[model samples]
Target chain A: MKLSELPFNTQAKIISVDKKIISRVAAMGVIPGTEVKIIRASPLGDPLELEIKNYNLSLRKQECKLIEVEKI
Target chain B: MSKNLALIGNPNVGKTAVFNELTGQTGHVANWPGVTVEKKTGKMDKEFDVIDLPGVYSLSPSAIDEMIARNFIVKDKPDLIVDILDATNLERNLYLAFLLKELEVPIIYVLNLMDVAKKRNIEVDVDKLAELLGAPVIPTVAIKGEGIDAVKTKIRKIFSDGKLAQKSSIPVKYSKEIEDKIQRTEELLKKDAPHFLSDKRRWAAIKLLEEDKEVIKEISASPNGIVVIENVKRFASGSEEFDLAGERYNIISEIIGQTYKRDKDMITTSDILDKIFLHKYFGIPIFFMIMWSMFEFTFRVSAPLGTLIELGLGALGDLITIAWPEDAWYTSLVLDGIIGGFGAVIGFVPLIFTMFLVLSFLEDSGYLSRAAFNMDRLMYKLGLHGRSFVSLILGFGCNIPAVMSCRAIESEEDRLTTILVNQNISCGARLPVYVLLGGFILGDGATGTIIFSLYFLGIVIAILMALFFKKVIFKGETAPFILELGDYRMPTVKYTGIHMWERGREFIKKAGLIIFTVVVLMWVLQSIGVDPDTGLLAWGTDPENSLLAGIGHLFQPLFAPLRWSWIAAVGIVFGFLAKEVVVAAFGLILAGEEEPEGLGKLVVGNLAVAGVAAAAMPALVYGYLVFVLLYTPCVAHLGAVYKETGSKKWTLVSATYGIAIGYILALIINLIGGVYF
Candidate 1:
């Protein structure tokens, strides 16, 4: 499932990140094989703030759609 | 004898943890040089003084943090420079190591984060790498204190040798044509500039080849500048190396291919994320929502704390009045000037703290760089270099740091432009203005809308200013920014909390210094008079009657054109001293009213007056806000301008230009509104 489609605060393991999101992911140090734990999602479940590798990052729903992930 | 050493690397390479392992004492962390980047210095287990410079990618200073690191290395010239290379990202880390080596300083390489590398199934042979570079390379897990003692013992032995080991030439690989150009430029440079980092000079030439503005300016300003520019330009233009960024990337790619082995898959992570976030249709809204929430949190989460701070100041003022019942001057000084003025400033502490906390989270978690990347196109549209986006973001914290952050832009023109536009960023200090005015002029719920509008105003004004400055002041080609978007990391809560509190404590400390002095000065000005018996002091209740009031009156005609009442006019005048003081003065004037409840009541009532279905109120308020927004930034910000620009002329230009633009805009708003209303 797309990461953005998940309910708020849902934990997910990123399965595949699309090629186009490289710059954004690179900026955030998010590489394809990293586990992402969602901490909070904006009311709409679009800009999700996630906990990863000892840090928290917020990404928009549309942005999250690029990442292929599965709920844990 | 153990010699002094400093570990310098870009932030996040475990410099602090390494310092802790080496020193055994929790290192004392402060800002590097004058910049806000954190600096850690301590004794190496009671053997040597080890300074941990803020994490910086390269020695060519750009940001406050980078400048601090660069200046310390250049000015302090530590005995040995330990360049900590992140094992996972050796190529980029080595870019800085290459620069350090060029400084003619002996740099020992420590490949940190080996555990993380191992987890990733990446392997690096430390001995082979050391042999290749002619520097001892030690692999260690900085977090676990692994191999740190060995690294320190090697440093001691190297110091005992009394002569540093020479590293073989690690000439960064560029294209063959570019390499030829560098060799030519090196020959020309060798004749005159012996003291410079010859390799750094080569890099600077290439940056200039890429038409880097800041480097160009530095060269142009020097006596040898014209010659260097002509020589480099000849080589740059001849080879069509204007695509310097692409060329540099290619070189890095080639070098990585040869020396480093990575799971070729790592690059794909960032690309995938960038696609959606950098997508034209969706990226902007996502960015806007993030900003909206940031402001929302800044206001909402802080409301309770704001009340607490306000009440604390109120109680303190009440205590002073009760304690000094006999001393009216001192009582007024404490209550009206000190408490009142200071309270107006301190009231925004909650928002400041929360904002910093969020900002630190964004920065440490690596979202800020993404935001910067997403904003790059817009920044270009606004006629600003993308690097300025980072500084502008920093401006949300404080104009001083923001102004200082401008150094990150490699172009002098961009740096100056960023500094000028920085004031329009509306720092936390000025948040009180938005909170006060938005609350006072708009209404309770509308306060958010008002603050949002004011922020929008700042952005619009910044865009306009950029356009104007580009056309008039610093006219040249708009330098295209090529930014490296770092990967995302889960932000460390402990680090983010520390960063947030550190900034909050700074705001409190600034109140203790800058606001304290100004508050006392306000009291002194209020107290002085010619005669007590006549009750007609130097300046009457009318602003024209007193010293500051008299000066304010001199500018009344200028503001009169804006439709401000004399008291309102005077408030804007005192705003130059500090924007927050505008509220304090406004509070004092309304307190002069019959049954006035001071600032709080004045804000609530006046905002209602403005919100009522009256065209005149909106017009007048809009005009008033324009003046407030464009006028000279506070004295502290001006001091910051002076420090950042390092010129009295530019500071004057910034102050005068802001006031001039503000006056004209305010005049237009009021005049048009007057006719329509």
Candidate 2:
């Protein structure tokens, strides 16, 4: 399933990220098999937050859709 | 021994505080030659020099900041790197540390914010971590200047003791497949690559494998080297499958397990605050309350000081008038031209300073990021990045810094669009015009709502324009929102005060001379004209027959559709210099009135002579207010646009677009208010 479809506050494991945004996202320490939890979405819900590697990183929904994830 | 050291780390790792401790207060900030990224360099105890690089997530060149960081390290080859890390965020922070370590520079690992980590029960074993990374480790709580002596002692030892053992002994080794290619690249680099990195074969190898643009371009200088790079590219290797970042993280996870410890169930204060601040339903209203209180506090609290300044300038003008009672040109020039015009703008210093203080406080406290996060969804819909929202909020204080603030934005198209629309976000300079016009013409009770509606209209128009620009001009995919919601920390009193003072001082410096020169010129124009009876150029003529009146009349027909008078048109024309002069224009040409109680009354008293009827003042001024809100920001702001964009064409676009939109919006307001009045 897509990371964008993950329920709020649920834990997930990254599968693969689309090649186009890989370099940008990879620098933030997001990569295949990294454990991530969707913390919350913004007020209007287009940009969302995730708890990854002991830090909170925010990403737009358009970006999240490019990452594949499986709920753990 | 004179040595060079570069300071680098991931964003929000207390890097600036660490730099302050290392260099004291002697740091000089400048741009990196051509780039807009600020480069901070300073001398360490007058013995060693330190260059502070921009914070980045990694060494890879995805963003302009990252590119600069990578280029600085590779090109300058500083003797040692002072790598600052957030001890509490050991895993994420170590990622960049490893990338820097690959540059083969001896590093002094400074674990900053140790006090916060101790409170959270995260203990980083300094010695063990130092042993693992093969560097001298010093634990520091930089804000208090704790543990800095040890870091400095180690730096001095490395310089005087002998040459550095630059490369890490226990480097994070790549996969076997990647290692083979690295070895092959090493041999090729030693033979064909520049002699600069030849001695540093291992680092050059990794950079080549990473396809670093600089490394490739340099290697392309040699014909044989170009073929070798092309060969490496054409013949694929299994090493390509290895995720370099993930591999580094995996090794860091190992190092973290051995060298760091924390309570498993510790939930920080930052997490708790994020819950309420990030709450969906209450979040937007809370954000608005904060903004409202900031503006209201600026208005109500700054009133006393603002009034004092007004009275002081007014008294000085009165004294000058007493000294030169004659109808000489210099007397009117000193009294009505220089004093009157400059005084009108200078009186708002208190309001501007107070606003800067509050804004600096907000930016330092880390709520600004949450504010950006909260506004992200709305901003993205408006055809702007979440970061643009921060710049627009800064625009409310002043647009010069607001336009400069767009450097944080990564995408070029998004940054440009934000810069273009920023002038519409009414700044502190424009506030004087609003209050004077709104209070006198619109009445006290409705003025509050009137001011609020004007601000709301600015945002509405900014968003629509951004959307239009996105769809019609400079179109591209949305700039991805990738922001670190860093740990919330208390803003130090010293830093916040400095930030506030510097910005407020900057505004005065930029505005002072421009306001003086333009006001003086306007006075001369308004004071001179042919005496209608004698048909000769003379001073203190009827302002209707003054030289200034000719300039105002030249543009009067352009604004005639709004039923605005030539005087109001003249105010808008002078506003192009600085918005505050709009009111000064009114005060000067108010039928030469003898110092009415205040500018508000002066504007009201001149309505009949301005060709604006008393009953029609509100509608005409409402249109005038809209024009001021959206028209070209002052000259200083346009200069900032040109500096930031580095394109004359874009600066012209930024200027012209505002006037076009201002006319259209103001006309809409006038036509609508024409029915209600």
In candidate 1, what are the lDDT values of residues B63-175, reduced to their tens digit? 45655666666667677888888887776576577656545567788889887777666767677677656678888887678998889888888877865644433545556
Per-residue lDDT of model 2, residues B245-289, tens digit only: 778888888889899999967999999888888888988889999
Docking class of 2: medium
Residue B179 CA displacement from its true place in model 1, Å: 14
Docking class of predicted structure 1: incorrect
Strongest candidate by DockQ: 2
Those runs of model 2 whose alpha carbons end farther than 4 Å from true positions after fitting are B1-3, B162-172, B194-200, B234-242, B321-334, B524-550, B587-592, B607-611, B675-677
Q: Report the C-alpha displacement of residue B168, candidate 1, in angstroms.
A: 11
For candidate 1, give the lDDT: 0.66
